[model samples]
Target: MLLPMSTAIAQRISLENHLSLETLRSGAGGEHHFNGMCQAACIASLLCEAGYGTAREGLFGEAERVLLDCRRAGIETENWRFDGKSYRILAEVLTLHDKQLSITPVRELIRANERLKTS
Candidate 1:
């Protein structure tokens, strides 16, 4: 029988199995591993480099809210492509919430995504 997991245990599991930038870049697990998940990928990279607090500071909540709002507004949060808007919005949110975060990587990722879209 499958039992429900406690929040603490679930959190630990999530922390341990974070998706990395390399994974996003290589798509080793799948070609679409990063499809429509740019927001999550960004947060995971930050958490991997910094710590859980980087996400706890506010990014997760803000990201969730953005997704929810998009859904409510009947916007299809692309499930087959990189979400550039999410990355851009997340970069801004990071600036507001965590001053110590290095967003250069995020900016670079955004540029890379843009190039992929154009090419």
Candidate 2:
């Protein structure tokens, strides 16, 4: 993944694996770490919804995704639903999980959540 000059270079290093993909492609992998975090978060949120809590632990992007999911689920349990933010999160998460890339920015999900007071 290409680490932009604006993002911390430290994010390129995997603290767990101790490997760096930073050296790939002249220090450009044609991807960004934030996108990876979004993909990872989507997967983690799905797994959590599937009753796998362990998947979310320690992942960089899982917290907010989980929070969003929790809010969505809470509304569903209350027999109410959001027309915009809920489906947007669901579609984006599924799209990212399937394609590993999304045209939608994950931050948009956060924004929608904030706008709706869902988180």
Candidate 3:
């Protein structure tokens, strides 16, 4: 059950769970144009951090990859909208890695590092 979360929350979670907003906001593949690109952006971030050049090179390409991988992983993507898919993709990525980080430190890091930029 991937619930739609606020964009603010999604941004924080991305920074905490994976990469920075700068990475997700990349102009690759014209991904920022779509409304359902959050999940793709998160996937792009993950793949980029994992040293995948193609993922770092584009967003929608990564978006397509996410959808495909999700299907292969027995997950669905039709329900994602707005910022909803961000959490869904992030959860899947976490599960793939068998890793977890407390929300507390992430929040603190956001407050200390990212909040000022947004504010």
Candidate 4:
């Protein structure tokens, strides 16, 4: 599977530039599983941003840690089911688990959650 620059390097790449496919996927090999597991991919990207690791190794290991982090941060995750489509799960986890994150990746999710309260 082909992959573009990571969430980290993506900031530097010009969206207007016509990057070659080879350049985009130059270093890709076994670390391209984002399409099937959006949550995992987001978590992996977050972990990398948090100084965990670059390569997406040990999916189960990363998942275990993410769950633990959620629990430690008092985020209720027992009822959470990963359908691999909703990135909101990832956003919620990150938002609640660590309020220190710079990027608000789930602004829409936040608004939706708020709307549910006033409705």
- Candidate 4 per-residue lDDT, tens place, 1-119, comes to 12322455333322211121122123221112222233333444454455444443554355555444433333343332333322334434333323322333444324433554474
Structural similarity to truth (TM-score) of each candidate: 0.28, 0.24, 0.21, 0.19
- Please give, for residues 1-119, the per-residue lDDT of candidate 3 as tens digits: 12234457655654543432222333222222232234434433443354332322444444556545433333243322223364344444444322222222333333333433453
Alpha carbon deviation, residue 14, candidate 4 (Å): 33
Find the candidate with the highest TM-score and give its number.
Answer: 1
Question: Model 4 clash pairs?
Answer: none
lDDT of the candidates, in the order given: 0.41, 0.35, 0.37, 0.35
Q: Please give, for residues 1-119, the per-residue lDDT of candidate 1 as tens digits.
A: 12323446544534422342234223242333333344443444444344333434565556666545443333343322214564455445444323322322444434444654574
| Range of the 10 consecutive residues with the lowest summed lDDT in candidate 3 | 27-36
* CA lDDT, candidate 2, residue 5: 24
Q: In model 4, what is the error at residue 77, expressed in angstroms?
A: 31
- In model 1, the runs with Cα more than 4 Å from the true position are 1-35, 38-56, 75-88, 92-119
- Evaluate residue 109 in candidate 4 and report its C-alpha lDDT on the 0 to 100 scale: 29
Give the top-scoring candidate (lDDT).
1
Mark the 10 consecutive residues where model 4 has the least summed lDDT.
15-24
Put down candidate 2 lDDT per residue, 46-103, tens digits, no spaces. Answer: 4344333433234425346543554455445632222344334433444333332222
Greater TM-score among 1 and 3 belongs to 1
Best-first order by lDDT: 1, 3, 2, 4
Q: Is candidate 2 or candidate 3 better by lDDT?
A: 3
